[model samples]
Target: MREHPNVIAVQDALDAAGAHTADDAPSLVVILDEGAHTAAAAAEALCIEVGQIANSLIFDADGEPLLVLTSGAHRVDTAKVAAALGITKLRRATPEFVRTHTGQAIGGVAPLGHPKPVRTLVDTALAGFRDVWAAGGVPQAVFPITYAELVRVTDGTPTDVA
Candidate 1:
């Protein structure tokens, strides 16, 4: 199957950022047989633990887009996050808001390829996994990455999101 335009964008972004994936990686964008829109689905498809799946969640922080790369095994403590970032408000972005910020739907929001850079936070819990899977700009697509590489590629601050 041909790559989706969004998937291509993610590939280009990774290339430009010099992000490294497994040399023998199946594909820059791995198309799953079943939809991997949720962390549980992605984990099952990738045959990895749920904790290894990095969920790219976008939030509305006082009208600004904030990308939060959280671990599948945990839920983000919005209050804690706001306190950490010293922000007054941090709420989950709506579907429309997510699309506007990412140019992709909620389920497939990648860390990169946004119209512009959005402040990002990478969950420190992901450090426990050797390889983490992130959405590849489409529900059926995903890519492998490491916690450090994810932070570097997205220029995300590492923090305890749970």
Candidate 2:
């Protein structure tokens, strides 16, 4: 599991950024026995609140890649996000665009470790959780991180995305 390139990249990026969980432990990625293709599934697998799963959503914002780390409990209000970013358009990115910008597939995209840094927004709603779980470069892989750590590691702006 550690040998996977995407997992390696995510781990390296987490290490390089000095990310940590709410308990002050180093953030470590773990591969689940079952694949977690959605936040509800991830929450079910981990036995945690669905709101604790940070859904890494990629979007096309006026032709640029935008990453939104939103709480699984709520849907992203694209209109509000577009207004917040002062962009005329903001929509879900295609699978190709997601891969091209994030270097990982849609269901497994992590907040960091992209070929380049995509503009990111961390939902302020995520701050409600003590520890948030994000994809670790694959559908069955995930990692625990604090909201502050997520924002710091991704250099993401905290926004009310829901």
Candidate 3:
């Protein structure tokens, strides 16, 4: 398969994180819809429900990157999240801020293997699914992960994102 630079970077990060094995490398499918920028769009392209799509939202917490993997069907309640995290405030990150911290673009951020571990939160709603998919470092690439594995891989705390 052809490899994009971003995809390569994702592979490197996955390797570093000791995620899935080479024998079980996740498939990254590039869909025709570039508009798959949102979870609802992605789910439509993949023929899945919006809830099945995981939105890798970035929050700016005192200039630090805070990652939230939320289900598409719900909106993240930032105030609640901040309260849960014991942070006084949380703001949506800008595109530049996202790339600076995640080394991946907004529509294609993955859960783990960032240059540094962004303080992460996995949506409790995701636990409803047996499997979940995340961006594989590129907009077109994605991989499957279970809710349990998502927490294990990201070392993220479980909380209500919506």
**Could you say which candidate leads in TM-score?**
2
CA lDDT of 38 in candidate 1?
Answer: 88
Residues 99-162 of candidate 1 have per-residue lDDT tens digits of 9988999888988988889999999999988788999898888889878788988999999999
By lDDT: ranked, best first: 2, 1, 3
Q: What's the C-alpha lDDT at position 37 in model 2? A: 96
Best by lDDT: 2
Residues 1-162 of candidate 3: C-alpha lDDT, one tens digit per residue: 227666676666555555642245543334344546778777877777788777889999877889999998999998988887778779999999998888888888877657788889999998887667777776777766667767877889998878
Residue 126 CA displacement from its true place in model 3, Å = 0.5
List, residue by residue over 50-75, the lDDT tens digit for candidate 2. Answer: 99999999999999999999999999
| Error of model 2, residue 26, in angstroms | 0.5
Best first by TM-score, ranked: 2, 1, 3
Q: Which pairs in model 2 have colliding backbones?
A: none
**Roughly what TM-score does model 3 have, to 2 decimal places?**
0.85
Worst 10 residues of 3 by lDDT: 21-30
lDDT of candidates 1 onward, in order:
0.88, 0.94, 0.76
